[model samples]
Target: MLLGDVAHLRTGDKGDISQISVIAYDPADFPLIAREVTVARVLRHLSGVAVRAATRHELPDLGALNFVLEGALNGGVTRSLALDAHGKALGAQLLDLPLDGDAES
Candidate 1:
């Protein structure tokens, strides 16, 4: 199943680190999100970006998972040449990360 089918994304950044939170639309879908939205998967999905490290933080009570990707900015926002320097672009791109089949549903 597509991740967008179960959850939505929110993103922000500080220095060269990008943080993304995947929040389930319904608590029922948290299980699927927890199982599929992994650090390895996110790294692969965002392979184009030079991510130095990634950490996944679970917020079961919020039905969400937060990923902290380090060195994702290429450089600090002011120093980076990427068009969307503050990481606004990554959030939308991240939504396309694939989920295997419809098993999670």
Candidate 2:
């Protein structure tokens, strides 16, 4: 299953950093997201982008996970030549991340 099947994403960027938030559709699904969506996994998933490092912040109360990715924007909107330098599309890409099939419905 894809992460988008159980959650939605929001994205933001500043300079060379990209921030993405994944919010579970059901609170019960938060645990699965938290367990599977680690920093390592995110970095691996977005390897095409020049992500130097990543950090995952769990927001259990909000049933969400926030990831901060460094060097993802290629140098931010004003600096990068990339079309989507702001990284708005990155969130949608992340939604495509595959989740474990054993996840509870």
Candidate 3:
């Protein structure tokens, strides 16, 4: 199953860093999201964009996972030549990440 099937995504950016928040629709599915959406997986998923590092911050109370990705903006919005230098579309891209088949609907 795809993460998008169970969750939604939000994104923000600062300098060369991109922040992505994945929030589960059902609170019960938070555990599966947290377990599957790790820093390693995120970095690997966005590797083509030159993401240098990633950090995952769990927000259990909100049933969300926030990822801080460094060097993701190709030197930030003003410096990057990429069409979406702010990385707004990155969140949508990440929604395609595959999750365990057991992921709840």
Report the candidate with higher TM-score, 1 versus 2.
2
Estimate, for each residue in 16-104, the C-alpha lDDT of model 3 and write its tens digit: 99999999999999999999888877777776888888888999999999999899999998899999867578898888888886432
Error of 2 at 24 (Å): 0.4
lDDT of 2 by residue, 1-105 (tens): 889999998889988999999999999999999988888777777778898888888999999999998999987778998887565688888888889854322
Residue 57 lDDT in candidate 3: 92
What is candidate 2's local distance difference test score?
0.86
Can you write out model 1's per-residue Cα lDDT over 37-102, one digit (the tens) per residue?
Answer: 889888877888899989999999999999998999988787898888566688777777667653
Task: Name the 10 consecutive residues with the lowest summed lDDT in model 3.
Answer: 96-105
**Per-candidate local distance difference test:** 0.85, 0.86, 0.86
- Model 1 Cα shift for residue 87 (angstroms): 2.8
- Candidate 3's TM-score reads 0.91
